[model samples]
Target: MLEVDGLTCRFGAKTAVDNASFSVQPGCFVGVIGRSGAGKSTLLRMINRLEKPTGGRILFEGVDVTALQGRDLRRWRARSAMIFQQFNLVGRLDVLTNVLMGRLAGVPQWRSLIQLWPQDDRAIAISALEQFDMMPMAAQRADQLSGGQQQRVAIARALVQQPDIILADEPIASLDPRNTRIVMDALLRINKHFGITVICNLHSLDLARTYCDRLIGMSAGRIVFDGVPAALTDTIARELYDLEAGEVMDETPDFVTGTLAPAFGTAAVA
Candidate 1:
């Protein structure tokens, strides 16, 4: 189990994440939802150790990981892979090489520096690309792909990390509606197939309701609601987003009452 005890992040006088506490069981799919600047991203960054916390502790299986440094911190980081909103890929590198970068922590420094990847590592990267149906584009440069394609490649790279948990910070924020469904489905597939826990930050209530088994709602850098999607009623959503009556409904009418289709009215996956 993953336990976060009173985690907090402060930038000067402003607290980005204020005493946030939660626990996640193994293999659970979680969604964090809130308006912009609610500290959802900061919470994920802190959990991944990308952002230093000012207070509290992060425990994995009862061991504190917040204070780890050097090699210990690098291992912890490898155990939880992050997929960003920007699709952070090396624009000049081939797709296969980008995916293979996930193995850098495991291979010898000299081997990586010399670009002499082991056959097993190369096989793993190829398998990940095939899993996402991007094997044909393995030799193409990352910058040549479209937004949806690039995001899929990004997911494939995360898969090669063999992480215990995937931290996706708005993975689909820039995609079209069809691409959104595709990316969300790919994340869902990874969670179900590999039993990897996924903690995703999402802006769409319908997508969160359809995909996540649990939801954590934040407001003003504080987690105000934590429960199953069904428990997130209209009133609670309003409080989470500080919306007035009918405003939440106006924003996501289908998801508010559980009427949205599972397919999300998107074109068939290509």
Candidate 2:
């Protein structure tokens, strides 16, 4: 449902994303993995049009997303939602209200500014939180919750948007192992149940291997590997990071939750 061709983004003399090309099928879960400067986040931002590409084109359902502007761009961006590394919520607001803000795209700014969400919209927001097991925290201030709770709330916010695709940029980067599991499970549940295509940028190969249907590895500014999780051979892993496969696998314990690290080779990123 999404196609990217020769996508390049440069920041002056430095190229952050370069000549990358890939497609994502509707209802599929995709993982983009790489080291810190690997262009993973940049690529996702480009797709969401937060970062205008310096060259190339992006097509979503056969329309050129790179060319969208004004009302069309706003609507397209709303359809392709974003979940940031940081839980970008109004911390002082009640959790339910924060989630309700997802519907702001369809509401007038004046109404939203006055917190005048309709009952139907409030119902949908509440239901979304319930789906993520976050209903109990609906009345709490968002900043009052734990990191995991906040992330789940962020997911609920995205859900209430009724987005067709979610671009999660390192969604689990800051949480502990347990919270990591919680957030990852929420994303999995959304993708498997709702068939909302999810393209996530992840630092953990174990998570990518366990949860993603397919993995795309980025190096510097370009895509170096794109295939099913099972197809990410040890040799390719070595080439992607210039590390022995065992060395890469050894680092799994540092990122994944509990006993999940040991299952890197066997798990399906479920």
Give the number of the best model, judged by lDDT.
2
Clashes of 1: 0
Q: Enumerate clash totals for all models, in the order shown.
A: 0, 4
| Residue range 1-270, candidate 1, lDDT tens digits | 899999999999999999999999989999999888999999999988999999999998877889889988888888888999999999999999888888887888999878899998898888878777798999999999999999999988888888888999999999987788778888987787678899999887777888999999988888999999999997787777775334434534222223222321111111
lDDT of 2 by residue, 1-270 (tens): 899999999999999999999889999999998777889989999999999999999999999999999988988888899999998999999999999988888888898989998887887887787777788989999999998899999988888888899999999899998898888877887787778899999887788898899999999998999999999976787778665345456656444433322111111111
What RMSD does model 2 have?
A: 5.6
lDDT of 1: 0.85
Determine which window of 10 residues in candidate 1 has minimal summed lDDT.
261-270
